[model samples]
Target: MPSPAAPPPPVVTPFTGQFGLAYPIICAPMFLVSSASLVIRAGNAGGMGAFPALNYRPLERIREAIRQIREESAAPFAINIIMQKSNRDRYRHLELALEEEIPLIITSLGHPGEAIRLAHQGKCRVYCDVVGLDHARKVADLGADGLVAVSYGAGGHAGTLTPFALIPLLARHFPLPVVAAGGIVDGAGLAAALCLGASAAYMGTRFIASCEAEVTSTYKAAVVAAGCHDIVNTDRVDGYPGNFIRTPALDALGLEPSLVERILSGSRTARRSLARIRATRVLFGAGSSRATYKTVFSAGQCAGLIDDIPSVQQIIEETIRHYHAIKGTLP
Candidate 1:
């Protein structure tokens, strides 16, 4: 027989078909890390790429970034938006995304009903990131096209439950597609998510080590050098729980801001904005900070899987290859 017809390849799910992606992977829209180059490269490599809308300033820059991605690659990409009250410019970013006619929108930190409505009006798909079943049900009722189960061990404002528990919980209840996030760094993780009934995987920490990522050499080096034990979860940054590599600088930061500090901040929007600025400065080296690289670094438990920094294309291709290789060995 003619090679058994190559086993007919894997069945394409609704996610891959609807988005026209070759693989069921989404490069999480990591703030300050996922840049235009990373997004374009990931898309060209047959997986969906994304970046945070807040990464760009003045709105026009984001428009230009979108234009550049479209001009350079035909693969689908997404823009992430913080939907909470702190993101004062959420609607402004949404309007810009709609104007650009972007392919996908990922909403986090708040309700998705308004976003789902506006995205649908613009013919774009909206996927909300949820930490638990209640959040999943809320987003589903709001007509979210998909749900990203942000489980424990994820980087940058991670959830509380483990993927083993979170993915199936959402899959069992929600009728829409589910994307598994948190601690997913390689093809094996992707395969596990699929086995759990998730249609795709959303990965952020792994991409920080990508050649296309906007992270510095110090950040990349830290991720490569660290292991799961080095990862720490704290609420000091942004007033919410987030994962990061343990360091002296991180240790020195307070676990949570004081109640008086919260009250004196005038408004919720102002407090959130200020918190973000502080976090960026202390952790990401966004402003004048010389010790950012050595003293602070954000990462997930998946750092254990990253051994080398590779190009986006190489990463995606190798991941898919490994997935097939692993699947071939199974009955």
Candidate 2:
């Protein structure tokens, strides 16, 4: 994509206006990839950036990271909280977010009822990540401010529907703003998403290759070199189906969990314990096993669209330029 010769046109929508973003993009939160610097850069660049609360361990780091971003930049940023029963710290994470008066909270994997209530009380907004209309309706009914339609080809645990199908479905059924997530990486994608009734584009895979991402260079290279075919869905990583690049490290993990592993994963409690074990291995580990775990990087099929490692600002600016250029040619 070429750089813009002139200033990009305003692409503001209700989502961007409400979130104080100049661009209709959200750097979707990733488990290990999203960092404070990435969030700050994305926000300062006129797009919202987020990181999972679990990314910072010991809990206090979450507060510190929030404060660090607040001190350094005035851009809007979000903290993701996995509301599943397994995330024992979800309450505390949400508590701290509300206590700090964070602007937005992204909830995933569980009902966001409590999060919505508390966040609204704290004068913040809650956006639930939904893969289908069923979940979208539920969250909307729960008074969620917006919906993040996580369509197929998304990096993490994605839904089965495509953005074309999911985005319109939610927009038609709910009055709230919808942010389309999935295989959106460029201005064409951002333009198409808005045309499909999305207020913003929720991007993850593209940013994984950004200079701000903290992943290993090998992981970044894999993302840059990969195509749609190189991306595969695997449940062995953490007992949930998430798309990942098929690297030698991912191949070594095997195709699926063992029989006993499968049975244990069937239980919520066991799944939680297993997730903690995986988190431990990934975040702080020593030995070859740890090295292998580190390679289990999550990415979307949109990795095929990303060829270069650019700064977060460059990505946003180029995307906005592309979007304007495309919008100009539209009928």
Per-prediction tally of clashes: 0, 0
lDDT (tens digit, per residue) of candidate 1 on 1-331: 4552122133356789888888888888887788888999988878899998988887899988988898999988999998876677889999988888788899988677888998888788999999999888888888899999999999888999999999999989988889999888777888889999899888888899988888789889888988899998876655567888887677767545678766857788876766666555643346664333335677899998899999887787777777878788877
- Summarize candidate 2's per-residue lDDT along 223-296 as a digit string, tens digits: 99998999888766655678889987788788767788878967998877776565445444532443333567
**Candidate 2 worst ten-residue window by lDDT:** 284-293
Candidate 2 ranges beyond 4 A from true positions: 1-7, 256-293
Query: In terms of lDDT, which candidate is strongest?
Result: 2
lDDT at 77, model 2: 86
Quick one: best TM-score, which candidate?
Answer: 2
